[model samples]
Target: MLDPSVAAVRRAVRVALSRVAEGGTALVALSGGADSLALAAATAFEARKRGIRVASVTVDHGLQTGSAAVAARAADQARALGIDDAEVVRVEVTGAGGPEAAARDARYAALRAAAAARGAAAVLLGHTLDDQAETVLLGLARGAGGTSLAGMPPSRDDGGVAWARPLLGVRRAVTHAACAAQGLEPWHDPHNAEDRFSRVRVRERVLPVLEAELGPGIAEALARTAEQLREDAEAFAEMIDETIEDIVEPAEAGIAVSVAALAANPVALRHRVIRYVVDSEFGVALTRAQTLEVARLVTDWSGQGPIDLPGCTAARRGALIVFTARA
Candidate 1:
């Protein structure tokens, strides 16, 4: 018999699975952590009961010395949980960034590829409330806009694969409890305890201080803040879309936004509108300063001049400000 907590997780997974399109398979990304292991176990149990098949994939990011062994262990656990098709994917991390970030990028890329191979309708991840809270805090520290402060979404589209986080509402402790109840021994990643990682620093040092000074429910509060910010960001994006429809015009070079129309909207909406225009035309996200500079070109510039942005270029063309990639 499944314990009450395990039953609750199963219920959550069932609800998440039910929301997937009909006749589509679900792929669970098993990392062997307590949260992801519990997610796989609950998802497998619920999927079998519903007569739906579930596939598991573990990404072996060759970073730590024991990563391959950990990935193998995760695959073994998935098979033990009755997952028929368990596969371990090997991916190499490259580029100039933090090792954790590079590994995450490679891992997600591998998962998307595996999902495509498995014909999965969506990829399920195990991002718990604590992870969400930590993300919110990290974004806050960066002092970015509301969108940055908004943590991971419960469901989002990535490379044509719907990514869903069924465990977002669950606490990490609850997942650990579920693992214990199921007699599963989850592997603990040493990197999580290393203070060198920014996320771990926030999770261990900063969050504890906040909880001590503010209250015990600080994490929950931050998670709630992220949820609220996400809603607000969505609505703001919708407004930006509407503004774009009203103000955007096509030019010989690229898309143009009417300076007069842009100036009519409030500053916040105007900044977002510029970002929307740049991203839609060039497939790039602009920094706050870049967006502001583009807005200035539209509102304050007197003549035509080029403004360079990452993977894009914005210029004031007569009464319209155009954004496009440099040739």
Candidate 2:
């Protein structure tokens, strides 16, 4: 008896595969979690039905005590799902940041390398609606503006490979149900239960309160908001590109945008233009304070001095705001 959730997940996988170019292989990133295992199973099933080859790759971050065993378990699960080409790649996570984030970065790096090596066109992840909701809440806690609030996208391109989250609309509970129906036991990562992690805190503490106060649909609402914001951001980016064609000019230090044109545009578009400038010239994102300061210089100060920013400086030069790094 096939679970309805499993059927729905298979449908989602088929839809996701349809978006990619035909006859290209897909690599599923399996992490032994219920969400990722379900994704791997669904992808394998759908790929077989569509006559597309699918490979499952698990990254062992070597952070946990028994990570290698866990990776092996994930590979076995993939093999059980008729994925004959399941492989486990080992990665060493380093840096001063949290171990969880470092592991995640290393894990993705491994996945990308595996996909490239296998000539895969896309890498499928299992981030679900619950993860999206948690991300939105974390962004709100930091008050990081619309971009942060947008959370994760269903599909994106990174390092010349398409990354697709096929289960973004599905709940975590559905994935668990699917695993149970398939008679598979997913490994539980202890880090997920630790309150030291902000996501765990949000999942266990904050989200429960929000659900009790605001109702059970809070996660759905946040995920929907994120999707809408992602679409709006994409459209805004296209507008910014068109606007840049007329206002942006190459300079010795960096790029310069006409202040008059920037001021004339709507405030929302103006912010996007500024962000584009900073990202293009400095290769860094402006903090909220830095963005506001730049806006003030462009709108209020007609001929004021330069304002120093991270990795670059913004100054008003002859009706044009020039952003360049200090020499």
Candidate 3:
């Protein structure tokens, strides 16, 4: 009999595999961690049943000693689990935005290249429900808006490559159980235990404390919140697309929105539109305070001068609020 944990992960992989074209390839981003090891094994089993080819790529960030060997072992495990095509790609992690962010950027770039070279329909990630919970908590701590709090999407397309997270709805513990049941040895990254990383701290300390104080299901609740917020964000995105086309027009150096049209919508929608305009046009995100200041142009027209935003300026010119690039 198949272990319940293994069955659960297989079910998820089956659903994610449905997105791939018939007999198409799917690449698994394996890290040798319990979550990713379980994901690779499940994807291998499910892909075989569906006549789909499965490949695995283990990225070595070269951040720690023996990282290459760890990656090679992960790839070997993938092969042992019925994934004949397993490869290890070593990436140099360099960039701004801290070590964690830089490593992530490099890893993703490698994955994108690997996926394109493999002609895989989708690249599977192993981010579990606990990871989503941590992401939501981090967003909340940063006071980010709904977009940030929405957490990671289950699936998204980037540069013609589809990225899928089959385990986002599954618990991390289940992955461990599944790996144990399958007699698979997973490499626990030492970085995951270091308190210097915010995510590690959140996983080791914050979540446990929250569970103790607020009951047993805080992680599940946080994941649920992220899911709900993502739904809301999708709905809002549709509404914005519909409303923006009618009220927005090209301006001298940027874009302009009809003051009357913006004023007619509810305050929530109004703020969203204001933020959306600046973000879509100027490629800069607006803070809540900045958004409200722009909204004041319509609500409180007191002959104020142009307000400078991150990459643009907003001012009420006649009957429209013009957002122009800063000279």
Best by lDDT: 3
Separately for all candidates shown, the number of backbone clashes (residues 3 or more apart, or on different chains) is 0, 0, 0
- Every model's TM-score: 0.94, 0.96, 0.97
* Ranking of all predicted structures according to lDDT, beginning with the best and ending with the worst: 3, 2, 1
What are the per-residue Cα lDDT tens digits for candidate 2 across 1-327?
Answer: 778989978888998888656577899999999999989989998888777789999998887899999999999989999999999999889966688778888988888889989888889999999999999999999987888899998898887788999999999999999999888899998989999889999999999999999888999999999989988988998888777889999876888889899999999889888988898778989887888888987778856788898888888888788888877
**Model 2 stretches with alpha carbons more than 4 Å out:** none
Q: Lowest lDDT 10-mer window, candidate 2? A: 15-24
Candidate 3, poorest ten consecutive residues by summed lDDT: 157-166
How well is each residue in 1-327 modelled by candidate 1, as lDDT tens digits? 768779878877988888666556889999999999999999888887666778999998888898999999999999999997889999989866777778888988898888988778888999999999999988888877899888999999877778999988888989999999999999999989999889999999999999999889999999899999999999998888666677887876678889898889889888888887777788888889888888888678877478998777888877778777677
Task: List candidate 1 stretches off by more than 4 Å.
Answer: 21-23, 302-305
List the global CA lDDT of all models.
0.87, 0.89, 0.94
Better of 1 and 3 by lDDT: 3
Which of the two candidates, 1 or 2, achieves a greater TM-score against the reference? 2
RMSD of 1: 1.9
Ranked by TM-score, top first: 3, 2, 1
Q: How does model 3 fare in lDDT?
A: 0.94
